[model samples]
Target: MKRIGMLTQIFIGFVLAIILGVIFGPSIAVVQPLGDLFLRLIKFIVVPLVLASLITGITSLNNVNKLLSLGGKTIVYFLATTFFAVLIGLAAGFILSPGKGVDIALPTESAEKAEAPGITETLLNFIPVNPFESLTNGNILQIIFIAIAIGIAITTVGEKAKPLADFFEALAQVMYKITGFIMKLAPIGIFGILAPIVGNYGLDILLPLLKVILAVAIGCLLQVLVTYSIAVRTLGKMSPLAFIKGIAPAGIVAFTTASSSGTLPVTIKNTQENLAVSKEVSSFVLPLGSTINMDGSAIYQGVAAVFIAQFFGVDLSMGQIVTIAFMAVVVSIGAAGVPGAGLIMLTMVLQSVNLPLEGIALIAAIDRILDMFRTSTNVIGDASAAVVVQHQENKASLAKSA
Candidate 1:
């Protein structure tokens, strides 16, 4: 008898979820607790995993210049690829015209408008007044800041910091063990998580917003298939097919969870095992990308903005379209890497272009469906960045050896 591959089992789980959900309908909600347990297990790993992995990753660097070089390359990769992501998103919007002849009734209550955080305030928030509080609060950006600062300080202290570094390194190993156990439960968790969603979101609810869904789907597909493929190949010097296959597990988890941040551990694990990224690089790049590189959300915001404008019969000016691109890029980079970031980005983009905020209500109805698609894309983009930067680091290491 042949043993089934892990991805194959997961695919089976996904297929079963759809089949059962359709047959059982809303009754499938009963299994949600199984999914919640899995989510809790994963969430339990997130804080400690991030803190320990990042701290060790930094200490391994052993020098500021190397750390700076890695950070610079990671940031540049994010910004450059994001430019193409936004362009692809906009192209999807223009071609699809998703809003044409579609009428979405705004909720009786006004859609809540989201306030964009100021750059200064957002940057300042990164520095945690109490690192323990940040950890307890699960503030990822603050945690990253804490980990980097501590890691850098440890690097400066040399051998004196060895005890602390050893502690974190050990902790990182323990977290990895825990993640492995949790991931074995993935097929079951995925079944539990997806069945209810499939049961709840009937075709009737999804039919009207079908175009909006298609536009976002097409945009995300292009970003992954086109943009990230070229990136991992030309810049990263890896086969695109291999890159896609290596990252598939992370993408599936992201789609089910609809959370790039929550899927960080899987991303790290996939890169290390499947993509050959070093622990040091994956730890830093994947975490930072979770918070900073929101290519998927940017795509959703782009398509939604165009849909809103067209739905209202508002003709978006050339300047407004450019502004949408600018805001999508900036707000995406600036977003706090939380669940509702898509709405926040959309609100800011629409407001900047003088489109009505009420359009948000229409999209909010089918937001979860859109989220599944975007979240998968976001994780894939995150992994691609990890691959590209790690490839650069590998090249640098080879050059040094030579």
Candidate 2:
């Protein structure tokens, strides 16, 4: 019965959203507020979730070096995966020719003329001058780095911080519970969000870019199913098929929710229940993944950058391609958990090559439609990591048993 209820709600939400969006067009504006509300609710919880979860996850670990090792491995894997994703995007955008011969006019927005941050400032600002303001402004990397520091401090204080440690542990549990409760409304929120999205653009939006979207989706799926599968099967030594199965719920939820952080709770739940990962690992890794490991979004940004470049009749040289790859990696790190995030990241990429910012307005029309695909891929990547983590622990357990 629980299974039935889950399936029913999800299916209904998706079907209804598409139907309503197609029929009403932008007149679905009434429901647009729900999308904003839903995103706000998710944003409201992110800071607390990171602080509590990181503190608890960190304090629980006896070996601080293991945390560093995990961080290093995760970042290395994320970078490799993102680099490949960017390559796939650039290659496909170049090969399939997504932006060729279009009569689309660019939208005029005042902000388009403004300069985006340079590589150095963007890097420096990541550390944050004021941590509190970073949180207030929704700077995810800053918030994450701060949580890591707080967590390490809690660990270092040891017994002296027992009471505080206990308090944060409880706080983590509370946040997880709140996240669980809020997730129940995801179906309704998804419906409300999609109703207007479909209404505003309709299927016609995909007309020009369907092939490109498909190419991008293929690249995303390859990253999740192929690249991640190898990581789980070889490095983590899990059954790749089982890993994919475990992540299905989270992937589907991501597809529907389209917010990695918003889907974090679902990813955690799915990792534990379906993937059989330990709570400790899931608690530690999933939140961080939500912030920094956006393999799917990275893929979209790479593809979209090249697509925009081509669409605007901008012929990028080999050096420019390398530049795009470099910029994509850096911008992707800063893009964590921002709503409609890929568009912003793509804007940064376009500006790097001196491409017209007007190109962004063209992509904006179809961004929501393409976003659904990439978000699913993002959640899949999260689940794959959880599965790999579990696989490593299981191997350790087996060794101990032997």
Candidate 3:
């Protein structure tokens, strides 16, 4: 019955948002408040949910070594999956040649150069100098580091911090309840977002960059279907079909919202409730994955690099491909946490290789469309990781018991 209510409300919200968007047109500003409010509510919960979940997830572990070992496996899977995604994107972009064009004058826009942080600086930044400041500013990576630190601290204190640990355990459950409550409004938010989206831009907006958009979507599908499924089968040793079925809800939310962080709640709910990943694993991995493991965005970066290069008729050397590969991995870390932020990161990528920023306008029109698909792929990747992580953890526990 509760499930029915959630589904029903989602549908109504979706339908009404579209109707009002079409009817209100420019006046979407009125209902826009509701959508903004919804987004704010989700944003409000992200930090607390991540912190609480991580604290609980890590401290609950009796063996700090197990936590570290699991972390290694999780990261290995993340890097492996993202590397495959990049390859798929590069291949698709090369084949489609979406940048082949007759004529479209580049826009006169100065590219915002990304402040390229050194490898040392990037590594140093992860160790939070001040944890509260990281939380206040919503520096996701820093917050994660802090949470894990606190988790380690709690575990070190052991029996002495049991009460404190229990509090966080309860807090994690409470946060999940809050997430479920907000998700009830998802359909309405989806409709409202789409209505203003479609009303303002119309179908004509898509016609210009349709080819590039389609190519990106195809690349995203390839990553989700090929890379993820293989990871689940060989590494996790799960049936690929079951894994896809498990992560579908997360993919849907991601596709509609285009925000990986925003989709975290749905990802958590689906991973734990529907897919049966342990709360311990889902709680730890999903939040970390949301901020870092962006297979879909990495793919987009690769494909976008090729497309921009093609548009400018600038031949990319093998060295440039290697540079793009390195940059794709780095840019994805920054891109996932920012909503509607992928394009800005893309601009940085093009400028790194001296591609014309003006070509960005060619893809900007279709950015939102591609974002939906990329985001879906991102969440799917996260959910798949959670399932594999949990299955392995369970298998280990059973073996020890035996």
Model 2 spans > 4 angstroms off: 1-8, 32-37, 108-114, 135-138, 239-241, 393-402
lDDT by residue for model 1 over 1-402, one digit each (tens)? 039877777788889888998889999999999889888898999999999999999999999899999999999989887888788888898899998989657777655676767678878988999989999999999999999999999999999999999999999999989998898888889999999999988687788889999999999999999999999998899999999999998899898888888888888999999999999999889999988998988899889999988898998889998999998988788776556678866887888889988899888888888888888888899899989998899899999999
Candidate 3 lDDT, tens digit per residue, 1-402?
A: 355755455556666766776676766755565666667777888888888998888987767998997798788888888888888888888898878882665545534444545556767888888888989987777888998988999999899988988998888899999998888777656765666765676656566566678778998988877888887787677788887776775676677678888888788888887778888798789888988888888888888889889888999999888888878877776564555567777876776788877766766767787888788888899888887787788788899999
Candidate 2 is scored at a TM of 0.88
lDDT (tens digit, per residue) of candidate 2 on 144-244: 77778877887787889899889988988888788777767767777877788778776676786686678778878778767888888887777888877
Best by lDDT: 1
Off by over 4 Å in 3: 1-30, 109-118, 237-241, 334-336
Task: Sort all candidates by TM-score, best to worst.
Answer: 1, 3, 2
Reference-based lDDT, each prediction: 0.88, 0.74, 0.78
